[model samples]
Target chain A: MQLDNTDRRLLEIIQRQIPLSSRPFADIGVELGIGEGEVLERLRRLQEAKIIRRIGGFFDSRKLGYTGTLCALQVPRDRIEEVAAVINAYSEVSHNYLRTHEYNMWFTILAPSQSEVERVMEEIKARTGIDSVLSLPAERLFKIRVKFNVSEVPDAE
Target chain B: MLSEFEKRVVREIQGDLPLESRPFAAMARRLGVTEGQLLDTVENFLERGLLRRFGAALRHQRVGYGGNALVAWVVPPDEIEPVGNAIAAYPDVTHCYQRATVPGWPYNLYSMVHRHSEAECRELVRRIGEALGIEQYILLFSTAELKRSSMQYFRD
Candidate 1:
């Protein structure tokens, strides 16, 4: 997906905000100097190309009384895929990833309560037959902001 | 406890918004509210700190920034604050947290780093380690992201 300056400008606009109004596209279009229909069409193309993952509201689960934890598991090499499937089955598991380490498989689970998180962990152990599951809940969160720079070239590799 | 209408708002708009001229208006119709009312409700939620942000979480890989790694450093008890602040100051460090360590895994401080390539990710780890003077640390690069979803509250 080769993004033009206008596309980058649109992404920059929406990354921080999207007006909560009857015509948010028109609001953005005005800033980009493009028509509402053009804005809509470009966004649709971005979606089709898998460029824009999501555009919506984000809520704080901790403020809403939810427990989240990052879990790591040492599944046997041959069973990584199989165990990952079992772990991904839980709705609480928001993120599942295969990483490079001894405790290779990692995932984060967000549940309504601590007990629910524990129950899901036990269930995963039981289902996957892997005892090396380690739960590393956040003791403190230092920073949690993520915003990608759109206009400038990305930092060098 | 959240009010019934507030819960409905969270449930309805937490997912993808429609890609149209009047996305919020369409959502307002579905939730039995006018566009102004829906917008005001969202404003209230933001003011109250319930809603984090109403924006797009771009695919980092798709935008040319490619590599990602979760580095856990075993910072000393006396240096946790300084180390965390320093790491979090980096733009590419999206997440920095102090997590409980298990028996064998001694690393306690975690920072998620994103770079343009795998080599750059390694470079970031080295730079952070050198700058922080942390001798013991481990880097875990995600080979695959099986699932990634934003957490939603008050789902109904």
Candidate 2:
């Protein structure tokens, strides 16, 4: 999609850490020499085009006192979708992906406590009937920051 | 004379940041605007620190840096900065931060290491241990990536 100057500006603002204010759009508009209505409109279009997937808080689960673990499951080729469905149904399972590995299905879940973490794993195992699930919890978090460099976008101007 | 139409064009690109080369031009054409205009706004955002960076989300595992682990250290309050900086200086360490530790869990300093093999990752951790002089730590390997999407704050 051809993103004009205004589109690019709006994207850069929305993707980064949003201003912790009541009217973030208005605040962004004031800085960009645009209006709040315009900010809202451009964001709407971005969503329609599937350029921006979702607008929500990237919470620090650990800070929230939640235990997160990344688990991989070796699901049968045919039952991939079924297993994903079962796994996604759990509110605790926040992020799941289809990776290229012997354990093709990789997912992450956040539990309130350690016992809940085990319970979620057992539930997934029982429901999917997959015995080769590997639960790799962070024994150490060496680095954890989500920084996407959007400034590299070519400037056609 | 930027009206709602022009604003809509801008918002579309903001919410939907495409993962492709010439994504801006593609967006401009869809919104029926000149590429110059799109580039101008993007530049403006860049200058204002609104946009951090734009690049490819490479598959770290496929690139042979598959053995990634999160390591946390229990450092005293006064030592957090020194420990974090020491760990961050390592090329193998991709991420480093300090977070509050629970009563039972005293691990506050955290770092992530990416290597081609698990053994390599462990070796890097060992080097970090020697460099930091802190013994208590844990290695939390990611078994799965449950959710890995950029935050969308503009949604209704």
**Which has the greatest lDDT?**
1
Model 1 bad stretches (over 4 Å): A153-157
What is candidate 1's lDDT per residue for A1-157, written digit by digit as tens? 6778898888888888888767889889999999999999998988887778899988877877788899999988899779988988888888898899988899998988899899999999999888987899999889887678767754211
lDDT of 2 by residue, B1-156 (tens): 234653454356435444233445667788787777866655554454344433223335432356777776778778777788778877677678676554445667767777766788888898888877889887766666645544322232
lDDT values for all models: 0.86, 0.63
Q: Which pairs clash in the backbone of model 1?
A: none
CAPRI quality level assigned to candidate 1 from its DockQ score: medium
Count of backbone collisions in candidate 2: 61
**What digit string (tens of lDDT, one per residue) describes model 1 on residues B61-100?**
7887778899999999789999999999998899999999
Task: Provide the DockQ value for model 1.
Answer: 0.69
State the lDDT at A144 in candidate 2.
46
Candidate 2 chain A weakest lDDT stretch, 10 residues: A148-157
Question: What is candidate 1's CA lDDT for residue A147?
Answer: 75
